[model samples]
Target: MISVVIPVHNEEKNIEPLFREIVAALEPLGEPFEVLFVNDGSTDGTAEVLRRLKERDSRVRVLTMDRNRGEAAALTAGFFHARGEIVASMDGDGQNDPAYLPEMIRRLREGGYAVVSGWRMKRKEPLLTRRLPSWIANRIIGLVTGLRVHDNGCSLKVYRAEVVKRVQIPHGFHRFIPAIFGVKNHEVAEVRILDRPRRFGRTHYGLKRTFEVLRELLTIRFVLGNRVFYEKALLAGGLISGLLAVISLLSSHRPFWAPGAFLGGSFLFFFVWHNLRRFNQAQKEGVFHVRELEI
Candidate 1:
């Protein structure tokens, strides 16, 4: 069975049309499938629309959050409830075409890849506002994570159920799915897909989102890349600084630089210890708690 997970926020107008497109695209594959629409606390009638879709089709499942968490949280919820061995994810804005699902799945299987990401080579959005920011963000993400994909922000992607489910996607980290999977040594393949213009509401992304992506990118580099090496280096610096401070005091000619060095080293050691504790605690907690789930 193939499970398609879509995370939506205030996209009531596009839900029905997108659902029809999904059904049309998947019916030809002759396989069991399920559609999960995660309503991320939209104030509009998005929840009502999703409930209606669920009633109309048995294959449609709706997971409504109690409040607006974020896209990453919504995807995490959908993954927890999804029962398929293979899972596909796309945005609910209708910009992503459902027609590419078959080819993405086919490539995933044939190429022996854990993930098949959609690359929107020719985007239909404005070059200044949407395209330019995405282009710059993708480049920075590639440079930081070392998993260079053409489109890191593309929502249309397919992944093996086990591989994706094991990943810990924090709030606002949905854009880094390919990099997160790559850091764990998962083989990811990219397929060019059609990018359609929005048919309903305004885009949620903008220049502000670009800054947020940069902040999250730094966090990913620290946590997922060479965290242990950094921790050890800080530990050694802290110990050496302490030794110098003690020697300076015992020499009867205390150096003024020793105090500054000791303070800097103490801050570094505290920073590493504090982050290590927080990281361990985060591992034991879920990204988002379940408020309600409807099938």
Candidate 2:
């Protein structure tokens, strides 16, 4: 069985169409499947539409949130309940095509990649509104996490059941799941998928959401900070160098001025000290413990 989980919010107009299209597309796969729709506190008629669909199709299940918890939270909830060996996720706003799911699954099964992400080759949304921010986000995240993906925000993503369960997701961290997998040494691949223009309600995301993405990118950097011992070493070295420079300048025995060589030597000593501290700490606490400290 393949579990397709979609997180929806206030997309009443597109729900019926997307559901019908998904049902049609998955029928030929010859395997039992389930479509899980997570209703994220939508105030519109989306909930009623999903309820009706669930009534019509026993394969369909609805997970309702008490309030709007964002896409990552909704997806996480759906993941826990998904019963399929292969789990897939896509947007519920009709922008992500269900027709490409077969190819995604094929690649995952054949290529041995743990996750297969969708690459929106040509987005049909407004250039200024969606495309521009997405491009900026992709590049910035690529630099930060070393995960060079074109459409990280594209919701048409597939993952192995175990891999999906292994990852930790926070609010708005859905877009960076690829980056998370990169650090964990998981094999990930992508395939091109069709991007449809919105047929009904306005976009759930906005400028504020983009800013939140930048903030999260910074957070991933901080979360992975201990992994880069050289950076912490440089910081510690710079601090000690600055302190030594100040001390040498004020000392009476010294040549009335701070010596550059002395400052450099001090910085080097502190830099080694910092690296040792980090290595010893990592040995004591373990790198996996990082997930426990929600920094």
Q: Which candidate number would show the highest TM-score if scored against the true structure?
A: 1
Q: Which ten residues in a row have the lowest lDDT in candidate 2?
A: 286-295
| Poorly placed runs, candidate 2 (over 4 Å) | 182-186, 225-295
- Tens digit of per-residue lDDT, candidate 2, span 123-192: 8877887889999998888888877777788889888888776444556667887665443435788898
Q: What would the TM-scores of all predictions be?
A: 0.82, 0.75
Model 1 C-alpha lDDT per residue in residues 258-277, reported as the tens digit of each score:
77777677765656544543
Compared with the true structure, all predictions reach lDDT values of: 0.81, 0.76
Output the TM-score of candidate 2: 0.75
Candidate 1 has an lDDT of 0.81
Could you tell me the TM-score of candidate 1? 0.82
